[model samples]
Target: MSKKFTIPSHSEIQNAKSNRNNPTPAIFQKRKQSEQPNESIIEENVPKQSSEKVMNKTSTFRSFQSDSKPTVPTVTPVSANSSQSPEKAVDKSGTYRSFETVNRPQKPLVSTTTPLLVNSKQRGNPILKHIHNVAWEYSDIVPDYILGQTTCALFLSLRYHQLHPGYIHERLKLLGRTFELRVLLAQVDIKDSSHICQQLANICLLADCTLILAFTPEEAGRYLELYKAFENKPPDLIMEKSEESFEAKLIDTLTSVKKINKTDAITLYSTFGSVKNIFTATEEDLSLCSGIGPLKAKRLHKAFNEPFIKNIKKKAIEEVNSTEVKEKCEKGIGNENDNENEGC
Candidate 1:
């Protein structure tokens, strides 16, 4: 038997090739379009060196860039009136601003010891002549004289206080809490000195300042000198003679009598050597003491021996003696009217 042969059209041929996994013309065109990068895609590869490129731009690295390009951040231009503010200079220097550590300058150390401070105004003061024992120099200080680190001195003349009574008060207020031991040296220059001195003493007491009364400027200077000289010494140096001595006690004892003054008592003690001997001495011996006059001596002698009787008994005895004397006179006269007094 003879078989009949048939020819397929081009469209049928393409459909058969496609079913067999053979690449068709449309599929090949799509593959070529994918392999050949788009011009827009290729132009997107702008880099740091567009003019001086290191590699060929037709590199295989640019093949899938259009499909797999990373989402690049869009940059917006800032306007002049934008709310954004420039960084502050302090923010950079302060903490948490930068990774680098911020180092601050350190403070200098203060000393525990300080030099003696004297007011510059006291340069020509005569009291400065006495401040030689301690090392001192001039300074623009507050107090009139800074004796020690915690001690100071303020001078006030009684005359000046009389003129400007509140001057010392102003000065005391100026001291404030600076000095622990404040001294006010007062020179008694006025005639009515005791009353003003007492007022100053009270002022010093309330102001916590020690008051030193001076009659002369030199004496005041000497006090300032002693304070500096004994600044570091123990307080017991002045506490030695706190109690009265034997001579002072004896003098006070002998002066207890109303008539016996201090000089008279001393004279009597020197003459008799003891209290018993002084009382036992005769009136003539008491008179022989230098200050005891004859009247004082006789009165002192009588005081020791006199009886302690009431004035009524002594007056009654004197009245009886006067009556007896009157009766004797009447008897001697022998008068009639005096007969009533005969019984007397």
Candidate 2:
């Protein structure tokens, strides 16, 4: 069988071809002359009157701005040689003022004189002078507060002793007395109680008085008991001396001669059997003792080796002999001068 085909009309064929070649308005314009040439045509067609109006508006705005705007005052730089304080610097024209100079006041100069620390009365007191010297010597070990408390305690204790002649013996009699004094003072709320106790202990030690083993409150009651037990006992006689242990005597001797602390004394005694052994011990041996470094050992050795009493006696005898010989020589020279005068 033969099939018949439907033919497109001329108009339909032309429309379809046009749509395929230029589907959108942009593509159709692109096929013509460039779009830049059209832009010039548009700008030429625009009215000159609109441009003139815009220029006139801009000119009016500029004039309004010039009239309404504020004027800024000119600022001159300040000079180094200006006749004004550093706080009050003057500008080159001398018109502008500094806020600091106007608002702030000048500070006064400070005094240079050193204020006196000790009063005249303290200086006069030998005890106070001694304490001050001790505090200075041991400044590294003792603090200012401790030193102050010690001074106050010593003053009060000495004052009390003076007021009560027989009550406070010439020497501190018992170690328990330190605790008793502390307990008596505790109710008064003394400042730095521990330091005060330590100072009192040191004073008692210097006076050759017995001292408490510890400064704790717990030991205070024990001290009271000891005081009661020893209260009835008669005072120790000078002639009838109590037998002190060898170690105690050794420690006392070491402390007195070497000026060492109790710990160092004990260490020395422990290392060497007796005081004689300690004195005889070389610096190396002394250094081997615990807590005694080479420096302290050298000092200990020097103190022991020093001929203190022997040197003093020898010096005294030499001085006397020299004086006698000088007197005899002077007499002899006077006799010779007389003989010469007689001959003349």
Tens-digit per-residue lDDT, 1-344, candidate 2: 89998999999999999989977787767777563445456446544455446447555322321336555555444555766654454454556566455459767697432221233332343333323212122222211111221121112232343445444333234223332232221111243456655655666556544344333333433433343334335567325674488877777777875548889998888778777798899999998877888988888998989877768878999899778667666666557775455342
Give the local distance difference test score of model 2: 0.52
After the best TM-score superposition of candidate 2, give how far the Cα of residue 172 lies from its true spot, in angstroms. 31
- Runs of candidate 1 with Cα error greater than 4 angstroms are 1-116, 241-344
Model 2: lowest-lDDT 10 consecutive positions = 143-152
Candidate 1, pairs of clashing residues: none
Candidate 1 C-alpha error for residue 199, in Å: 1.2
Let me know the TM-score candidate 1 reaches against the reference structure.
Answer: 0.37
Each prediction's TM-score versus the true structure = 0.37, 0.26
lDDT of 1 at 330: 63
The C-alpha local distance difference test score for the whole of candidate 1 amounts to 0.71
The count of residue-pair clashes in candidate 1 stands at 0
In candidate 1, what residue range of length 10 has the lowest lDDT sum? 92-101
Q: List the residue pairs that clash in candidate 2.
A: 175-210
